[model samples]
Target: QLIVVFVSILIAFVAYTSQIFVLWNSLGGAVAHTFFVLAPFNVFIIFIYINYALTCTTDPGTVPPNWMPDQNTHFEVKRSTHTARFCKTCNNFKPPRAHHCSTCNRCVLKMDHHCPWINSCVGFENYGHFLRFLVYVEIGSIYLFALLSNRLAQIVEELHTSQIRPSATEATFLSINMIMAALVIICVGILGGYHVYCVTTNTTTIEGWEKGKTLTMKRMGKIQNVKYPYDYGVMNNLRSVLGPQPLFWLWPRTMSGTGLYFPIN
Candidate 1:
């Protein structure tokens, strides 16, 4: 319920605040520019919601009872990848790269990290949608920043030159929009950059942390040293996660391979 409310408020704030400012700046020129430049954000908005729903609702994949690796050959599996194969809690053979999610109380394939904001674990099945959500938000927030900044600049230029002055209501609306735009851009842009790095480097937040932890554990002689696998170069890694088509990279869709097992470098 807390996550639901947070998501709801975020959506409402973005939609209502943006529309309010647009309506407030209803001059012919402003409306024309915004209609073309800002209207397309509606699609982005829809995508945000769609991706959010898919991420939260879609299971982060679980290994069934007594499940074995695929033997038939659609996805070739390397037996060497199955190193850490047991989960004491689930009392089952945990697949390679699978981790137990305490929140969901299950093992998630290619487990990334549990996101509290979304109230879900970002794992193989819905990782693409999670990335898409970040992309759309950054794009939309940046667009809003551009639009509002231009409007504010125009107002300031005219007022400073003694040509025209904005009314009190107009000034207030512009100020609010500017603040909102700044908030979105700063907050979303930095966060989106982290996700972008994760996608490019073929690592998740959890995986990155585990990499460091594994190094520490190995140094302390707690565990044998093991090299991190699953990196298939830069482009291949992106394609495997974001799908093949460049056009549909930002589109809401599933990734190329199943979440069960992944090919490694």
Candidate 2:
């Protein structure tokens, strides 16, 4: 996991460095144009690193030692059992939407999954940061791809209309950077898109799988209709993960809720 994190950072560093070099050299006297392109690119890069660091370092919310369910609030119990959900491993009451992660060796609140790149669980506390990291990565990669493509087109034009040709070294670096950007776009695009859907619907990856199972059982006439409790509505669900302020959704901040008790639909 550490290796993966290191490699991801290294790739970002290399791509950023190579793009700046290529752009500076290629757009010789167009300093204003360079700034125009780099201003937003740099912002995305900063956000990407910031969110990544937060996601890696933040605790994904853990159950208090010897914690028990509150009788005042409605709490989920073990399926088909009246007793509160419990983790034998943690020896503590499991909160609603919480799951025991074998990797972390504890129960995590609203756990989405264990991400290797960040070397942490995407759960209640860090989920916003995780999502921001993905958003920034995808945006930055797309920006890089556009810049690289424009440079490539210029090189091709120069070759066709003039005797000058781009240096082999620059071409090689450009190719590598472009390939890396494309991969990030495609991979992160799909991942980010899925998580966006999950957030809008107020569903975690684990709950999504459970929902599928429930549907199957219903279809087989083994169970009655079931509804996911967390889905308040499209707008409210988005606010749940991203916070109440739409203006600060992309900013670094913790989400609302105690992670132990969530409002139901």
Top model by TM-score, which number? 2
Q: Quote the lDDT for 90 in model 2.
A: 93
Error of 1 at 131 (Å): 0.3
Which candidate leads the pack in lDDT? 2
Off by over 4 Å in 2: none
Q: Residue by residue across 85-204, what tens digits does model 2's lDDT show?
A: 999999999999999999889999999998877766889999999999999889888888998899999988988999678777787778888888888899999999999999999999
Q: So what's the TM-score on candidate 2?
A: 0.95
Global lDDT of each model? 0.75, 0.86
Alpha-carbon runs more than 4 Å astray in model 1: 22-34, 69-84, 161-173, 214-227
List the candidates' TM-scores in order.
0.81, 0.95
- What are the per-residue Cα lDDT tens digits for candidate 1 across 1-265? 5886788577767655655654436435456665775578777778878888888877777777876656542343334673446677888766767788999888888898888878888888889988888888777767666766776788879878977877676677667766876787788778888888888888878878978898998999988978667677778778888888778788878755557776656
